[model samples]
Target: MVSSKIIDRELFERILEKKNSLDKARPLSAEIVQKLRQEMEIEWTYNSNAIEGNSLSYEETRRVVERGLTIGGKSLREHFEAINHVNAIRFIEKLVEKKQKITEQTILEIHSLIVKGIDGVREKGQYRSGTVFIGGAVFTPPPPIELKARMLDLIDFVNKNPDKLHVIELAAISHHKLVWIHPFVDGNGRTARILMNLLLMKKGFPPTVILNVDRQKYYRRLKEADRGKSKPFVDFVARNVERNLDLYLKAIKTGKDEQYISLQEATRHCDYSQEYLSLQARNGKLEAHKLGRNWFTTKKAIQAYLKKHATKNQKLKFIQ
Candidate 1:
């Protein structure tokens, strides 16, 4: 076993301290950052019943994301099922469209959904319905009398913490402590992951989804964290952050300055574009870049450049 000394918890804390700083990132990492976002969406958009290998292709997955963006309107479980569709187009659409609020009740609602479809989920939202064992030890939840208070204390801690801790650390601890408290009867694992991302997204880090491909490693890291080993889990999370950063960067970099398609530019490049890429970029993406003018990319860039220089009376004809 690698010695605990090799992975100092403080190292992780230092990283967390740094990441929480705004503008800590550079434009050079656009590609990687976008991929991370895509991967995270893929990971969270899973069905409890489906074989782990099942997934939507890139195009089909975006729609599911669109659904996730609007997930706030419905019951927790219904929203989860809607987002977990095996379609990339749907997933990305949801992700790009909406942002959900985080709160104690939101956590509970999600907890309810994660356990709802699982086998032996009869206990559903209640505290432990099935036997649980940890480290060859019989497991017992906090006394029923204490369960609600413990949960309340946790939510209070999350909301009232001083010094502005990194949301990821807050999230990791939420996973650890929630399991320790084992507040609900079921859905602990799934709910924990969802809450982790809720915290992540709340912190502007985007979602950090643990892919089925990384499930074994993820579990092992969690085990280490539970055993009073914090840095390994931090490393696991940092790696994910790094991965997500890669994804975001990718989405931003692929197009040349000219290809910077706005939502309005959609119709010209793709077969079905509800959104378009326009020269006058109005989204946060361009504002974040501190550019002189809103513009699309590559081919679209040329059109905008031409339109800007066009004679007032001349109508511009361009390729679709």
Candidate 2:
């Protein structure tokens, strides 16, 4: 697993910086921010599930989030059902079961089980992914024997420094380190992203999804971090987190003020049909506040969706 010396004083500082939400916040009016939050939450789930190969179109995906389940497919569907939720499960488990302590074993166990369904193709229970990138250059991994010890050391560092530094920063570090190790044979990218989310969730922050659409920007950020730079990776993670918060805050703001937007309104702002929007809200799958009989969602959710899932082979769009 991980070594004792990795979580030294310096690593702790980076964690602190990442977790102090207020320190780097750009600050926005409560009204604007809340709307963004509501929108991002709804949209991120849809897009993240899609890239995981969920195969649901915009409306169909919304309907599934609302009421349908693709249980017939490989376990991928079930896993996709809560592709965004495993982080929440990990958070509660850590706090309630492990009492806020992290160890190399804890990290491995979390990863092994969470991605279990993707085994053969992705080494569901594996690590490193046997994939390597020499500063943005993808290359075949070196023999596993050569890097196993370093990978173990990284794990040890993570467990040792559990609470001193911010989890987010550690997450960013682990993500880069794991990729560098190329420990597993597949699923490194997805696994790394989930590990990052686990870090945020450990600290009571919402898990962030780096959408496939943003793959270029996301890889660029990772490449920057591999250069042994801090801000670019931290900034990249911060942006993803803030994007999530913007959606949550938007929904929360309107949710607090009882501000309301309707399905037609949201879809118009988006491009989905009123029926599609209603199915989403009616089933309580999306973030929307109801006014009498009508409900409306913030624009962030809609934009993120349009950005990620609109394609030629749309999934079924009917409301369940």
Candidate 3:
């Protein structure tokens, strides 16, 4: 067995620290929480559905979710997907509020809302009775007969958290494992992502969205997990968790350092070009996150990076 670490321990701890900061600031005014929640719900719906190939643009999804207005050019399935995802998120929020345990029925119910009008009633929340295959996936899902047993085992693993994994790790693994099982004929991916956030929210983390812009890298990480290198997938999820935490912290203005600016705006304060900063962000050298196609980082992060590198270079010059 490769004893290689399964996640960036430093980054993971940094995320936990941010979660701690958010927790300490809890009981944020109801109005602020409500506004942030509304924004995140729309974003979560749009991105999750888009990742599943829904054609509605972000604005169309906002209209569908917020105003119940359908787009003229989009198909009925796409509209339903956007609306249903919002409904599913609301359902998960209620469960989180009630501190409910994640049962098999709960999973089915979330899936039910996700595919309500798009899929037939028999397949709405029900596990597939026939085999299904994921295009571009490295492995086939377990056969239908194995799904129930596999789901039960998954529920046990999540509920018990037998390995005592951190909540983030548990949620990430559960996300991949549910997709690995591919229990439902459709809506498996959406359900797994929702279920993953449900675990996070129940643990006091804000709702995390896996952006549509990340669709390709997201699949690649999942495929890596399938090949027994789960670290990449876990790190990917953790980065997203940090992103949402940054959003929450910023929304409340929890601290001055939490202010995040777009890479373009951030460039005005730093020596490096936006492209170079984006590269550093992608390589994990900078503390930043992507919102859609744009990357955002704090002035503090830029200053820290420059300070660290400048000192390193000065030491090398001294040695020379």
Candidate 4:
């Protein structure tokens, strides 16, 4: 069971607030939903593959999945990776639509779509038959002999939610544990991420993309979890969830001030300089997320931060 200390309550509540906002704005027009779904699918495919060292540029990935065109300088495997991932996303979406219960077979099917035409036929959806080690990962996976039991335990953990974990907590912990189990000889990272999103989507939350730019931080947090310091990893996952919720709200134009602005622009309402705000954003201190190379935060998020940190004697400076 994850300790209460593992997740930041403020961050967790912020995600719920934003998720509720998106929900309240629900039944979006088909055209808008379709457009947002398409944009997310491409971004999700690009980032998930990029984290695994796929060299396909975002546009190259878009072409491979959308146009089915072969990229000139990329390997067939890389192109296949892009295609396979989008297929995997669709598989999960269907499962969500049907409200399917996640089971061992369900996981296997997800992994199968991820590695199809890439891994050998026998290994495509199958657990490793021998021991394996993840490069640069702090912990070794359970041996092949323990794989089946470990996986069944994971499935039960997710289904039962014995600790009554929040959906996001359950998803993040399950993700870390799956990667820890190292169920497959390959594609475990991608599979874990997809499975995590499956859990999120099941709860009516949007699919969260862990950006490729945060790849190093992602691995570092996972390593921290392996070392029994789980908070950083869980918080890391929570931050991404909040970011996507913000994105969804922005796409739907849910509120007048819900849009994210560059940190430089955000400084107009607060005493912090752009550099300081960017630093806070990177540290997860301010409610901000990255757009490409720069950090973006909402005016509302800045006001919340100010209110939280201001002394009682100091009147809160509202962002008007």
- Residues 215-276 of candidate 4: C-alpha lDDT, one tens digit per residue: 99999999988998877888999999998887778756645465566688888878778998
Summarize candidate 2's per-residue lDDT along 1-320 as a digit string, tens digits: 22212334444344344434333443545654455433444455445555555555544444444454553454554445454333434443455345465555554555565455553545545455343544444444566566657766876766665545455567777777776666665445555665666566665565576776776776676766656665667666656666655433433443322333557766556547888878877776666655323466666555444545655333233121
- lDDT by residue (tens digit), candidate 1, 89-143: 2322343357644456666666555454545557655665344554422345576
What's each prediction's TM-score? Answer: 0.54, 0.56, 0.79, 0.79
How accurate locally is residue 30 in candidate 2, as Cα lDDT from 0 to 100?
69
Candidate 2, overall lDDT? 0.54
Model 4 lDDT, residue 156, Cα: 99
Worst 10 residues of 2 by lDDT: 311-320
CA lDDT, every prediction?
A: 0.51, 0.54, 0.84, 0.85
Model 3 Cα shift for residue 133 (angstroms): 0.9
Residue 232, candidate 1: how far off, in angstroms? Answer: 1.2
For model 1 the local lDDT of residue 54 reads 31
Off by over 4 Å in 1: 1-40, 47-103, 116-119, 129-131, 134-143, 162-164, 254-320
